[model samples]
Target: MKGNKGLIFLSLMPWLCMEADAAQHWADTSAGVRWSSSFREPYNPEKVSKTILNVTHVSQDDYGRNFLFMDYYISGMEDPSKDNATGAEEFYGLYRRTLSYNALAKDPIDSSWVKDVHLSGRMDVGYENTQLSPRPFKVRMGGLVDFKIPKGSLEWGLEGVYQKSYNGITHRHFEFDPSFVTWMSWNYPVTKKSQFSGILEYLEAIGEDGFGNDTKPLTIFRANYIYDIGQPKGFKVGVGYEQFNNKYSSNNAADPTNGSDQKTFVLLGSYHF
Candidate 1:
């Protein structure tokens, strides 16, 4: 039953992405596909594979900026001998739209720096169905403030998001909490075909409901080296790593003893059209 539902949703994604728009108000729209596989060893060794298709459209108007984004994911492998009856281990869908306004819209001096200091808010809704969890609708409401320093290449911003879950299994009940994230990145050109960029982010989640014990604070650091293949609109590749740690208590019985020390390496390739 689950496999059949996943198949039906996957088939409808392309049409939704292509025909959902009635008014052509966005500046540009882009679509892409991605695939990733991971291997992990935490007392038990396992492998996970995922494929995703995404589409995004953004438009800017006198009032603010608007964006529409959608994602579909399919996981696990297909093999009759390897517990093939389950089909895939996970499948999920996410759809979100956001609107932001700039307060210093007409300012001339330091226009770029001034505009980043704007008041913005957004709402997001998503659905997920996986072998480990049942289907649920999730919603997030958030606000952000972006600002940059003058006379320097330094920029910074802060944002807070609160999320809640509805219509899910016992363990996947509704939880409302806020998270704060701050990020900094720098861009440097090393020759015309290559560039180096670095980023750092800190995130903290406030607990709510009985699920509070499972929440944690995390910090992520990333550095990337990008090389242009040939043309202006060609291909690029990147490599990075991510590390995770738990900051809050755990509600799951199995996770407390295991600790939440996890890490992953990432490799990426993409083309622009």
Candidate 2:
């Protein structure tokens, strides 16, 4: 993925129009570090202690909304890097855009419990230097519905996309397969200075992977309780729990001893500006 810099630029071209046509609503950038001891990679038996540096941005405009986030997994051993004798690092980035149906339509659908709908798109790109050396890129097209709740809201989305991968070691492309994705997200105010939020996402199986292993549906769930420590400056601290199953589409029929399913608690701190 690092070598295909041009493709990254081309993929992001659609977002460039926002600056010219959209009126700014609200935007926030946040940085955080999270640590977990149960992080797993496919086929690996060891549950490694992972340190992740995260950067995120969320914004909304009169027309729609956008979310962009990146994660950097840090290593402290002398494993992958030779010159500096550092550990291997992995990176993943994602961007999502939603065009509001209510804002664009002259006659929008409205009900007591339904808020709005959106046409949504998302792009996921990732690279890892571990044994599989997988480089994944996916694009999803879908629709989302926002439903009004008593004190919060629920958002549900579904998408269809094809997964494409490049093998760094083999210098070849993997078999292309179609997949479906769906997710539900929600937030509720726990207090004036705190909130409870979570997202549960599922990815349907896309048959065999590059390694000739049968793939299974994947599930990822995360919940967080956050407090605004610096309300004036938008600083926050939070704790989270994450549950992942059949990570990276690994076959569930394989050994349970393999670190394919993981549940872990995370420590998080972030500053938004």
Judging by TM-score against the true structure, name the best candidate: 2
In angstroms, the error of model 2 at 116 is: 0.5
TM-score of each: 0.59, 0.89
The local lDDT score (0 to 100) that residue 162 gets in candidate 2 is: 62
C-alpha lDDT of candidate 1 relative to the true structure: 0.49
Q: Per-residue CA lDDT of candidate 2, range 130-212, in tens?
A: 65567888888788999978887689999987668876656788755778999999989888899899999999988887866
lDDT of the candidates, in the order given: 0.49, 0.80
Worst 10-residue lDDT window for candidate 1 reads: 39-48
By summed lDDT, which 10 consecutive residues of candidate 2 come out lowest? 76-85
